[model samples]
Each structure stands twice: as C-alpha cells, then as structure tokens.
Target: MNRYLLAGAAAAALALGAGAANAQAKFDVKVGGDAYFEAGYVDQDVDSGLRSTEFRNRMRINIIPSAKADNGLEYGARMRLRANSGASNTRTTDADRAYIFAQGTFGQVRMGVSNSFNDETYVTASMDYLKLGAYDDVTAWINLPSSTAGTVTGNSILNPSIAPDANSTKIVYFSPRMAGLQLGASYTPRNDSSNTDISRSKPTGTLAGTSNGIYQDMVEVGANYNNTFGGVTVKASAGYMWGRAVDDVVGSNYKDLNAWQLGANVGYAGFTLGGSYIDYGKSGQNERTGVFTETTRNWTVGAQYTTGPIVVGANYKNGKDAGSLGTTGDRELQVYEIGVGYTVAPGLTLQAQYDYFDLDNDASAADDKGNVVLVRSILAF
Candidate 1:
C-alpha cells in the first residue's frame, strides 16, 4: 500500500468516527510494514560439484491498536502478519499477542495470550530486535545459561499441565514496573482429545523425562530486572515451566524446563555495544532425558554507530549443540553479518546487508557454508 494513502485513509476514518462512545473512542491508527529481498551466489571447488543461486524474500506487517483516556486507563493489542518466500505454500494465522490491558502506578496486568514474563528483561542488551535478528527461546538464554535444554515437552491436550505452546489461547499476568523489576505468569488448560481420553502410551524416548502418562495442562512464571549502574545498563531474566507428557504421546509425570538470560549494553556518543548469553536445562529421567540433556548455548556480541540519517552495524554469533544421546558427535554453527541503513524520510527507509554462516558436524548430513546479500525497503510510522 502507498504510505501516504494508507495514512490518509486512517485519518479519514478517525474523523468520521470522532464522536463514538468514550470507552470506544478511536485514537490514531498506524499502518506500516517492510519487505526484504535477498539473493545468494556461491562457488565451490570444481571437483566438489556444489554450486547454486538461492533467492529468498520475506514481508511482515506489524499493527498496533491503542487507546487512551483522561483518567489514564490505557488498553491495546499488538499484531503481526508475515509472508515468506521460503515457505511459500504454508499459511497460518500466527498471532503475536492479543490482550486487554491497563497501565498505572501499581503496574500492568493483561488478560490474554501475550509475551511470557521471562521474555521481557534484557531490553537494552538484546540485539535480536536490531542485531542478530533471531529471538527465540534458545537465544533468550544468552547470558545466564540455565541447565535445562531449550525444548518444550508434551501436548496440553494430552497433559493439561505440560503444554509447550506459548503464544495463543492462554491468559497472562504482568506486574507494573517497579524500580525496574517486572514479574509475569501465564496458564493454559488441557482442552484437547489427548487430555480427556487416551488409549495408548507415549514413546519412552532417550530424553522424554517424566512425561509418561500425564493428562493435565500447564503454567509458566518469570521475573525480569533492568538497572543502570554508572553508564551501563544490566539486565537479567529467569523462568521455570513444569508439565506432564503422556507415553507414546506425553505421560503423567512432571517434566521441567528452565531458562535464564543476562545482557548488558553501554552507550557513548554515537556508539552502542551489547551482548547476551543463554543456557538450556536437562531432563530429569535418565532414559527419557539424555537425548536433550546436552547443554546448548547461544550468544551474540554487537556494536552499532548512528549519525544523522545513516546507521552502520555488525554482529557475530556462536551457536553450539553439546551433549547428544548417541556417540554421533557435537554440532556447531557460527554466523556473522554486516549491514548499513539510511533513512530517506520520516516513515521510509532503505537497507543493504551481507551475511555469512557456517555449520559443522551437522547431524543431518554434509557441512555447509554460504553468503547472502539482502536489500530491503521499510515503512514504519
């Protein structure tokens, strides 16, 4: 959509509905998204016989609906729609978050599926939003490095207390910010077929844990803290989740997953520097947990400098998979990228980036290395 036309249409809608109910009064509606196109060309030893050109693209739209009142009771929801060329044939409604929340001195409590509590801290050190660009649970453990493997066990349908899904069909609570301290929790019930009536036993894998024949749902709790000392900001976050997994499916025993992360950022003049560390937990049962008991760690250290309308940045990430069930081997991957961006207008920008990655000891097959070039046009208001 044309940026100007989209803005104009939203403004007109607000003008037409200016006198609606006070509680339902419309505020400014912002519309914008971005598209990224990338192409890669690689060369290898002639005898190696490996050559190819890969094209990949993605488009994402982020929408936010917000409202305010004279008394300061605020409410809103955040939405995201994404399209990818790699997964061209797949389509699903991936709701990021939806909640009716209020903000005040006491804090904010949201009633709906939203970001988990443990996922909130490390705002300053987290470059996933701008640096490494990968923000899943594995990456969430950058600093603290817990003992649990970063995998979810069991289905809530089979065992209500152990469901692994994080985003939708759940209720979450977030406490207001107090001296940079934030707390949150979320719960989901077992409302599926596997939970109500199960006839078969689940598989007893090498690392399945106590997930033998359970049939209850689950909950997660987290705490985050951010503080500034001298000139640097420090962040720490942790969370614990326990649930049941049936036999062939997920059993009745309790399986635990824990995650902890720490991050720090320093700014001086036009330069910013930051990094993060994460650790996954181990399974409790000897037979059902060792496959995932190996500790995996991921981290990124990045720096960026912005001046006027231009910004240049680069990042390095190290990913490791240690501790496997079999005698196969360990897996490791390293990624590096450098990019530059320029703002052409208030809501439009252009960016160019180059990325390189290498994977060794891949459990699937041969080793691999590649380079990628990307060009993007972004519109955000």
Candidate 2:
C-alpha cells in the first residue's frame, strides 16, 4: 500500500493529538547541544614518546528549524556544528551533521549528509561513563603504534556497528514503529563524499599493495526493537551493509564491503545488561597474493546500574583485525573497564572511569598492557 494514501489526520493522531509537543513548530529555530571536558592519565608499556596525561574537550551545537503543515506533514532541516579538533589541527568549526527531513503517515525520510540507519540505531553494552556514545576513545590513551598493528584493524577495539558510511551524503527511510519495532534503510552514492563535496569520478586504488578503504553505492538495512514487559525493558538492533570497493589497478584486488551488527539490552529497575557484535568479513581488504588478510571483528558485553543521581558500570570489550596487512597475522585489543557517574544538576554531570587494557600482536612479541583513568565533566541542554 502507498504510504501517502494514509490520511494526514491519522499521522497527526499517531504522533499524538494535533496539540503535540512540536505542532507546527517551524515558526522558531531551535538550538541545543552538549559539551564535555575530560582529563586522562595513562600508564602503558608502549608510552615511549607519549605523555602520561592529557586534557581534551569537545563542544557541539545543533541548529534545527522545523515546521508542520496543516495536513500534519512535518518538515525540518538540521545542522550540527562541532568544535572537536584537537591541538593537532586548526580550531575551525565544522558542521558534521547537515540534513533535511520530512515525516508523515508514510513514516520519515532524511536526505543529505547523514549517517546510515545502523549507525544511528545500533544497540551495545551498557556504558554510561563513556562520552556521548563512543567505544574506541580508549585507544587514544594507549597510543598504540602503527608499525606493530597492521591495517585492517580500526582505531578502537569494540566495533559496535558498521560505520563505513561515515555520514556521507545519503537518503534514509524509516518505517513507522509497530509493536515496538522500527525498520530503516539508507543509500549512499559514495561513502567518501560528505557535506558539499561532490565527485563523479570512480574511486580507484593507486598504491600497489595497500587496500582501498573507499566504497561506492553503499546500502544499509536495519531494524530495532524497544519495548517494556512488566518491570523489564528490552532493546535490540540488527543491521547489514554492503558496497562496491574502489576500482582496482594492477596488482590490486580490493574486496567489496560486507559488514553486519547485532546487539541487545535488558533493563529492570535502572539496571541494564547489554552487549554487541560486529563483523567486517575481509571487507575492503587487498586479497591479492603477498597481501595478508583476515576477518575484522569485535564484541563487547557489560552491565550498569543507576540509582538516584549516581550510576556505576563495568564491561569487557575485545577487538581484532588483520592489522598492518603486510604483517603476518592479526592484532587483538582487550579492555576491562569500570566507571561511575554522579549527576550534579540538570544537564550537568561528573564521571570517572578506569580501564585495564591488553594488546596482543600476531606479527611479533611486541605485546603491551597498561591502565588508564579518565575524569570528565559533561553539560547537555
């Protein structure tokens, strides 16, 4: 059945009575965002040239203009400005998320530079201590070397989902939720292009042995479930992605992208247990002879408890990939973490976490292990 066939009144009713929270909200531009300041201390075996302590902070602002038609058709445009560049680069701000969206009885649609469906809605381990929602920030403290760990492995050990889309220019469709389940999909012409950038030429590999990470014509399909039964809450997500690798040159044979993600969570009385698994099966690897290749994957599981304004949590994450393709084998990263948070006031909180990490290299005996502690203050409005 055609979604447009559905009556606009029905859509308005589904969203709540016409007096809904954002009814015809287009008259005014809305602004909101978050900021965080973090201080970290690391003691690792590989901290030869790295400092034992560092401070980092990030800020973002979201500008959204939205309106609802008399027929209940809602339309909006959003731009998220970010000032996250570290001391390594210029302090210029950039808009990482810029998109336009429309919603009605037919569900919702988003176009422009935006994330894939999976990236926007993948479930994972309970980690309230982490910033916003990131799994690999710990890698920054370790300062792992590239020479020992090879190419296929990513920056973080926990691959929570397929993120190759990287917020490229794309179109996404979301189905109306039914019985606590929602479905979504996205299409990207090229994963490497974002914002105002445009490239009609085919991406081609230039190096002889290195694999091309760029992919074209990417597609993603995903689903999520969120419901409460009695005193227990359940949440889950699954997704798959595929794309064509860059055009190959002589001595280069790049594998197409094939990635998937699965995750779930169970919560009751402020206590939540969750985990996730992600796999990129030789995706974007140079399969030609003399170039090493291996499955890139990661998994994580953990639990957290929240009481009043305080929360505590712990989790384990393991990630592996064919690091440094020319290297003999894969590299592994294991992290055991514990953290706590205290809410000081509305939109403000303090958090601290401790992490024990172990790094194992398949190429040689340059194994490393260490501990990291981070303290952070967050403000959201």
Candidate 3:
C-alpha cells in the first residue's frame, strides 16, 4: 500500500472508531494549542552577522480527537503545526505533526512520523525533559566534521552528531509497563523524501571535482528503564546508531559509522540529579589518506528543584573531541550552561537558558570561542 495513503486509511479508521461511540449519544470535540514570543542573542567572535534579536522562534497550534468504541477500541490522533519560522529566538518553523494509533492488551501501535523508539531511550522522567534544557549544548556534545569536509574542528555546538529530520516516517510500539521498564524500536526506509542523511563524510570528488550522490544510510535502536525503591526513583538508558556512506562515484566509502550513549537520573522529594555520556566511534574514513578519524565525548551533572508552581534547574557540561579532520587546531571543544524553568499551569511552561562554547585548537588561526542565550515558552496538550 502507498505509505502516505495507508497512513490516511489508518487515521480514518481511528476517526470512525471514535465516532461509533457517539452513535447513541452526543460527542464534543477537544481542541488545544499554545502561542508565545521569544528573544535570543548569540556572541560569536568570528561571525558577528549571525547575532540578532527577536528572531522569529515559533507560533504553534495543535488539535486531537479521541473516542471510545462499543467494541472496546479507543482511537485518536494528535495534530500540530507551526504558523511561522525564525525571529523570536533561534530558527524554528511552523510545521505539523500527525499520528494514528490503536491501544490493545499488548500495548499501542502508532503509525506516522512520530517519536522514534531510539528517541524514547535517553529521555528521563525529569522535568527538564519538557524544557529547553533537554540536550542543552553544554551538557551533551559529540565529535563530527566542522562542515562535512573537515574545514573546521569542534564539538556539535550548533548541531548534533545525529538528529532526525522532519517527515521521517517511523513505526513505534510501546510495551505494557513492567516494573518501571519500557521497551520500543523503529525502522525507517533507506529512501524517503524526509531522509536527510546528513553526515560528516563527504564526496571526495565534489570538493575536488564534481557533486553527485553522497548520502548516509542507517538504522538506530534504544531502550528506557525507570524504577523506584522506597522514596528514591532512578532512571537510565542506552542507545546505538550505525550507517553507511554512499559516495556515488566512489561507491560506499565506509562500511560503518557507529555511536552510543548512556544516561541516568535520580530524584527525591521534588529534587532531581542527572548525568550522561556519549561517544562517536572512529571506525570509518581513511585517516591515513587525509580523512582523519574523529571522536567526541562529553559528561554532564545537573540538578533541579520544584516548589509550588515554580521549578528551577542548573547544569554543567564538559565536552572534548580528538583527531584532526584536516584542521590545524587540536580538534577539541568545551562548553558549559545554566538554565531555569517555571510551570504556570498544567501543560504550560516558561524557560530561559544560557550556554557558552569554547573551541580550543592546538593551532592559533582558528576562531576558538562563542556564546548563546535562549528563552522560550511552550504549551503542550
């Protein structure tokens, strides 16, 4: 079946299931969303033009419809879309997210571009998960090319070593909760319009000759676990990713590019402490032939406390990268950040965060430092 068409059919089935419950009664639609303004500032020593104000951040709208069927089938789908892009803080867009799923004894099977199983693995039960502090550059860092071809060297300050692109369809299955452990997984096709395949590897001929097919093909997997003993709650997770480079003329230049991460969080009496570590392997590329093996790793420790309607948190992140990707510097980066968040009401949050980036190079020619600040508000239903 056509994937998009199949997804549509699934959504229709859910709507039908929900409507059947109202055949003998009246049903009302439930609607929700949030709109907010943001301001941001960046201090990069090299490129001053990137520094700006009130860069349009995000204007959001969301909706969901759900109903119980006479046959015991409960069905629903959540829809979200952005109305604008950029200006308020950093660059963000008004986009849409939709999902269709059915609940069963085993669990729930969701279809559409939703959160992948790999994504569920690292997030903890901490309040920061719902805040901007999640994946704050200062706390979580990785080693990757400066710009694909090794023109620069540093941590993934402005970007992540691996990030999912939009419209990337995934199938996620959530298992029944068992002693605080939840397992899940997702599979994505090698060729999808949303397949970004952005990677550190580049087409050798492009920089030196021509531009052709050069994209990364890959798969990812992860798991999540949480348990409570008495008054103490603990959460932990691990994940792995692997991909191949299709260099077109050069064909598959590398067989494997792999990475993994481990994280943990502990909470007690309205206070929580968290830490994590991530490493990207140096298994691919012919470093001997000028394509150097690059690796990145980092560790973070932070805490959060909540009182009444207010929550506050602060974190310290330390990052480092080694091996030269054709850069004259030591190929290392370090960063730190602190953040604060507040909950005004159920499902409504306001947050402000600031972080600094320091690119330390063994060579003197590279631009070695920068800073960033972000403030945001979100309404999730």
Q: Which one wins on lDDT?
A: 2
lDDT of 3 at 115: 56
Candidate order (lDDT)? 2, 3, 1
User: Candidate 1: deviation at residue 334, Å?
Assistant: 1.9
Better of 1 and 3 by lDDT: 3
Candidate 2 per-residue lDDT over residues 1-381, each given as its tens digit? 122322232344345523344553555589999999999999998766778898989999999988787767677889999996747777878888999877776687788887778888889987887778867788877876554222222325465868776568887777888999999878777877888898888867655645767777777889999999999999999999888887867777788888889999999999999999998888877788777888888999999999999999999999888777787788888999999999999999999999999988875656899999999999999
What TM-score against the true fold does each predicted structure earn?
Answer: 0.64, 0.90, 0.71
Model 3 agreement with the true structure over 257-312: per-residue lDDT tens digits: 46576778998988998877766554243333444345555566678887777777
lDDT of 1: 0.48
Could you give me the TM-score of model 3 versus the true structure? 0.71
Stretches > 4 Å off in candidate 1: 1-35, 40-51, 62-66, 69-71, 84-94, 124-166, 188-255, 283-293, 322-327, 362-365
- Predicted structure with the largest TM-score when compared to the true one: 2
Clashes of each: 46, 5, 11
lDDT of 1 by residue, 1-381 (tens): 232342343344333333332575576555566665544454322215343455555666767777765555555665656674235657544434455554544355554555444444333232322322432212211111222222443211001112244444444556666897787665544312221244343334333442222223445666777777676555555555544443333432233344345555666566778766654333222334324334445666778787888888887776664323342454565667677878889766777766566656434444556565556556554
Task: Give candidate 3 regions above 4 Å deviation.
Answer: 1-30, 50-55, 84-96, 124-134, 137-146, 149-167, 195-217, 247-252, 282-288, 319-324, 328-331, 345-348, 361-364, 370-381
